[model samples]
Target: MDAHHPWNMIPLPDHTDLNLAEIDVFTIDGIFSTPRLDNESELGYSDHHENDLSTPVPSPVPTDTSTTKETWAETTMAPPPLNRRPKARTLRNEDWAPVKDRVLELRKDKRKRLREVKEMILTEFGFEATERQYKWKIDQWNAGKNVRRNEMKAIVRKGQIRTVAEPDKRSLTFELRGEVVPKEKIDRFMKREQVPFDAIYSPSSGAETPADGILDCWTPATRFSVGRTPTPSLSGEALATNEHSFFVHNISSSPALSSITTLATSRPFEGRSPRLLHSPLAVPSSLEPNDVRLRRQLSNLEQSFGEGSEPTLGTLLELCNFLLVHGRYSSAETTARKQLAACRSLYGDGHERTGMTLSMLGQVLMLQGHYEDALGVYQKAGVILKQTSGPKSEPYLRNRIEEGVLFRCLTRDEEALEILRRAEATAQQVFGRTHDVATYAQLRLILPLVELGQFLEVEERAKELKLFYSTVTPTSQSRRIIWDVNHSLGCVLLRTGRLKEAEEIFKSIWRDAVEISGPEHPASLSYLHNIAETLMLCGRFEEAFGKTDTCISSRISVLGLNHPDTQASMRLKDRILARQRMVSRVSHGDIVQSGDVM
Candidate 1:
C-alpha cells in the first residue's frame, strides 16, 4: 500500500487488515458531516434493524461501491454558492434631476406638509426620502433661485441688456428686450432735464410742477440767498417779536404757520424768562451756542433749497450730528427723520447715503433710552449697509459697534458680546488694529466685557487702546474714545478693589467729559456717577455725597427723573448716606470708650 494514499491516512485496529478497495470512504466522510434530523432518524432505523435480536435482518447482495463512492466524492468536493442579501436603495443626484421641477412646484404649495412632499416624491418618482431630506432639497433650490434673481438684478443695475418680458413662473429663462441705453447718456439726459431749486422755490412756482405742493409752505426767497441773516445776540423772544412779528400778529389766519409757531413754542428753554415763554420761537437754551448756529444754518439751507434738495439734506445731517454731540437726542431724532426722508427720495432706500441716515437715526434713538425702537432701527440700518456697502465696510462695522453698544445698554450682554466680538475681529482684519474704526470697536467691547465680569481681558484691551490713543491726533471722536476707554478702566479698577486708583481715573475722565460734551451730556453724567461710586467705595463720604448729588441733579435734568441713570444716582446717594451714618456711629462709640478709659 502506498504510504501517502487516503486509505493509509485512516486509522484501523492493530490486528485488523482491510483491503483498500473495500474500505467505505463515503461512510467515513458521513461520520464527520453535519447531522440533520432526517439523516439521524434514518441512521437510527438502520442501526435498530441490524442490532435487533428477534428480527432477522435480510442480508442484501453486495454491489460494486466504487461508482457510488466516486459520485459521492465528486459531489462533496464542490463548494456551495453564497446566499447574500440585496443592497439597500440609495438616492443620487440624477434621481432627483428628473423630478426636481415637480418637487419645486409641490414646495410652493404652503398647504402641503413636508411628509406629504416626501410621500409624493416616493409615489411619483419612486425616490424614497425623509421629510427632512425633502425640506433640505427644497431649501437648496430656493437658495439657488434667490441667487439667480440677485444676479439678474445686478445685470439690470449695470445697464446691460434689458428684460422685455417677465419670466413665466414655470420658465427658467428670461427674454432679452435689447441693449439698454448707455448709463452715461442717461445721466447726461437727466442732468439736462433736472429742475433748478431756484425755479422750484420761486414765488411764481406752480402747483402743477413736478415738486407738487412740497414747496407751498416755504416762503419765496432770493434765488441764491437765505431769507434772512441769523442774529446770535437776539433772544428767542426778541427774534419772534422784532423780526418775525408777522407770524405772531397773524398766527391765527395761517394754520401751517400757527402749527410751526406751536411746535417751536412747545420746546421752550428751561431757564428762560417767564415773559419770553410766550414767544413762538423759544429754542431750548440747553443747545450749545455752536449748536444754535448750526441749527440756524440748517434752517437757512432748508429755506433756500427746500428740505428735499441735496444741500438742505446735507445741512440737516450735519445738524443731526451736532445735536447728537450736544446730547440733544430729541432734536437729533427729529432732524435725522427729516434727513432720512430726503435721502430716501434723493438717493433711494438702498443707497449708502440712506443707510447712513438710518444709522444716525438709530444712534439718536439709542441715546434717548428707546432701546427696542433703537434695535429695530439699527437692524434696518445694518441690513441696508450690508446690501449697499457690504458687511466689512467701515460704515457697516461702525453700525454694528453701535448696535452692540445698544445691546449693552439694554443689558443683553451675551448678544452684545457676540456682535462686538465679530465686529472687532472684522475691523482689525480689514482696517488694522490701529485704525480708528477698529479702535472704536475695541472701545465698545469694554462695557460688555465689564458686564460679563471679564476683567482681565477688558484691562488688557483697555491698555492697548490707551497706547493707541497716545499716538493719534486728538479730535472730537478721539477724545470721546479716550474718555470711554478710561471710564472702562476705572470701572475695572473699582470692581477689583483698587479704590483710590479708580477714583483718580474716574475724576480725570469726568473732567474731560464735562469739557468735551458739557456737564449735562449722558456720558458726562455717567462719568460723574462713576466718580461718586469710586469715592464712596474709598470712604471719602463728603466728596462722594457732593459728586452723587451733582450726578443726580444732572441726570434728572438730562435723562429725566424716571430714567435708570437718575434712579441709580438716587440709590448711590442712599448708600453713601448709610455709610456715613455707620462711620459716625462708630466714631461716637469710640469717643465714649476713650472717655471711660481716661
Candidate 2:
C-alpha cells in the first residue's frame, strides 16, 4: 500500500507529451502537489515567501509580460478531464437464486411473455438482466430439467423404477369404434399366455405337422394370426435330441423361421438408406409429447398383460399408433418393434397379425426416412398379406397406399404414381369409390401427381375430392381428410408460385387444425410451418422469421430439438435471416449511391 507505488498512484492522462510542471497530481491523502519549478521567482512567487502568512509578496511589475503570460498559459491549461469508467454489472449465482422460482413460475404461465417475466423479476426481486441474458438462463434451466427427466425415464424403462401399481387380475376391455366385445371373450384372450414354439411341435410322428392348427379356428386370420405353417420333418439324429435342442436347431436351420429370427434380433434401421444418407430432412427419434393419462394407461396395460401376450401386442399397437399420430416417430419405431416381437412370439411368422404389424412398422420407418428398410418391411408384409388376406383385402390395399406414399417421399414420382393409381382402383373396386377407404386412397394420389409436375391433374382431383366431402356429412375422419386435401392443394399452389394463395390456404389449415386439435398439436405445428415457408417464399422475412421461430420452439417441446421437422424450421430461419441481410445491404447501397449523386 505504498502511496508512491505505480499500483497505488492515480493513472496518468492519455496525452503523454504534456510537460510535467503543467499537470496537477493529486495524492491518495487528498493533498494536491506539483513538480518543483526552477524559476518560481520569475513567475512572481518565492519558496521563502510561502512561509510568511502576513507578508505581502509584491507581484512582479510587468517585466517581460509576454514571456510571463506564456508560462502562466502553460501552467493554467488543464489536461482533458478523466472519463469515469462505468462499473460492469454481471449476473451472479446469488443474484439469480432469489428470483429463480418466481421467474420459472411466470414462464410456466403461458400468458406471460419473456419481457414481462424479466420485468416482473426486476421489479419484485431486484434481479437485473437484459432480454438475451434472461432467455439464456431460462433455456439453461430447461435443458437441465430435460436431462434429469430423461434420466428418470431411462431408469423407468430399465424396470428399476415402477411408477404404477402391481397388476390386477381384473379383466380389461378395449372399446373399438363404439363396439364392446363380450367380457368373456376379452378375459379369455387376455388370459391366454404365450407357449413355447416347441410345445406345439411333435417329434414322435416324424412327419411334418401344422403347428396350432386348432387354435387358428378360434380367431379370424384377418384380425390376428393364430395359425403357423406346417413344420418340416426332422432327421433321425435330430429326433433323438432333447426338445429344447431340437427347437434351437429348428429356428436356425429352417428357411421359414430365418426371416422371423432375423427380424427379432436385428435392428430394423441398421444401415443408412441410400436416399436419406445426406438428406437434411432425415427423421430421427422424435421425443414424445407429455401425456400423463395415456402414459399411465399404457404402463398399466403393460403390467397387466405381461410381455409377449396377445393383449400386450394389442396394447403395443395402440401405443404405436398414438405415438405416430402425435409425430413421435422415434417412439413409434420403438413401440412398433415391441409389437412385432410379441406378434412373432404369439402368432408366429406369416400370420396376418404379423403382417399387419410389419406394415405399421414400415410406415413408421418410412416416416423416419429409412426408405430401404421400409421397402423391405413392406415387401415382407405384402407377401404375408397376399397369402393370408388376399391382395384385394382392405389391409393389403392400405399397405400398398402407404408404400406409394413412401415412394412419393423418396421423390420416385413415376413409381409412386403407378402404385397409387393401382391401389386407388383396387380400393374403388372393393369398397366403392365413395367409401372412406377408397376416398383416402384417392386423396393420397394428389401428392404424387403434384410431384410428377401434373399440376392440372392434381387440381382436378382435389376439386373432385373437395366436392365429394362437401356433400357428405362431416365427421372427425372426414374433416381430417378434407384438411389433408386442402393441404395438398396448398402444396400445389406453393410449387406453382402462387405464394399469396398458398399462404392463405396454409393459414386456413392452421386455424382449422388449432380448432380441432389445439395449438400445440403436431398437425397445427405442421400447418404453421407451411405458412412460414410460404411467407419466406413471398419475401416477408420478418413475419417468416417469427413464424419459423415459433414453429421450431413448438416442435422442440413436442417432437424434440433434433427432429427433422425442427431441423427444417431452423434451416428456414437461417435462410430468412440471410435474405434479410441481403435486402438490408442492397437498400443501404442504394442510399449511399443516391447520396454520392447528390
Worst 10-residue stretch by lDDT in candidate 1? Answer: 268-277
- In TM-score terms, candidate 2 sits at 0.51
lDDT by residue for model 2 (1-598), tens: 5557744433322334446676343432232334433434655454444344343333433223233444644543323233465554787654564344345434543455788877665553345688778877765554111222222222222221121232332222322111233445433332342312222222233222112211111122222221222221221111111111101112423354355433321222221111111211222324322222244445555457654567566656776786566555544665566566566666767688988988998887776556666787887788778778999998888889898888887779899989989988988988899876688888889988887789899889999999998998888777888888999899999999998899989999899878766676767888999898898888888899889888888777655464556677888898888988998899999999999999
Off by over 4 Å in 2: 1-257, 260-307, 311-316, 328-331, 560-562, 581-598
Flag regions of model 1 displaced more than 4 Å.
1-293, 578-598
Total clashes for model 1: 0
lDDT of 1: 0.59
